[model samples]
Target: FVDVLNTMLDDTLPLTPPEWPEWGNPIESAKDFRTILSYSPYDNVAAKDYPAILAMGGLTDPRVTYWEPAKWIARLRATMRGGGPVLLRTNMGAGHGGASGRFNRLDEVAIVYAFALWAVGMAEKAEV
Candidate 1:
């Protein structure tokens, strides 16, 4: 979502816009709320055999909740014919703004980035 904004808006929009994009409509350019939720970046995470889902949800966020990602994982987990890691990082302390604690935020970001890299087999994890 941020990637799309940074790409499309480029220099037009400020770092933190006075008013961000509204809720409901979500497609890149299709311009309809119904179409947005049915298909978009959201659907990309849906099962690709044994997809590695980096599902994160802010418990305090009204838009995206811990339950949303949990449900997504439940679907993916159900369809993963091959057993794999579907990392769910639900930050209990985070709002839509994200995690606030210093060390915890560092861990949160690292885990998410690392999980993404690890998911694609681009980075190796050390056995503990």
Candidate 2:
């Protein structure tokens, strides 16, 4: 919790002031603290079942570091009370936009489709 909040504060503080309401002024406000805490997926993970989650990340993504999704999956696996798998697929050579070429993009799309089909028990019906 502290690490994620600190990272978010560091990243967003430069673009906006601490008093900025857009992000709930997490630096020095108690009300804002509650607001941010209320909506944080990590902090508010309920002890209930969840659908299969396929989280994708890029090694060089500037906006959302790869570790965020990695940590999210870890937490989901530890806390969630479901059989649905929580998977994380990191693109080792890609950034925020993923692989650059048309064929490479299609490959990424195929992976997503494959995951979706498997999640819905339709993998056998997939033609390719």
State candidate 2's TM-score. Answer: 0.78
Residue range 1-128, candidate 2, lDDT tens digits: 21245454563534345335567666678877777777777676677898988888889876567887888788888889987778888999888898789998899999899888888888763553
All models, RMSD in angstroms = 7.9, 3.6
Model 1: weakest 10-residue lDDT segment is 2-11
lDDT of 1 by residue, 1-128 (tens): 31232223233434323323543323334454344445444344444566566778788865444565776677677666664677677788888767887987897888878877877788877610
**lDDT winner among the candidates?**
2
Question: lDDT of each model, Cα atoms only?
Answer: 0.58, 0.74
* Angstrom error at residue 7, model 1: 26
lDDT of 1: 0.58
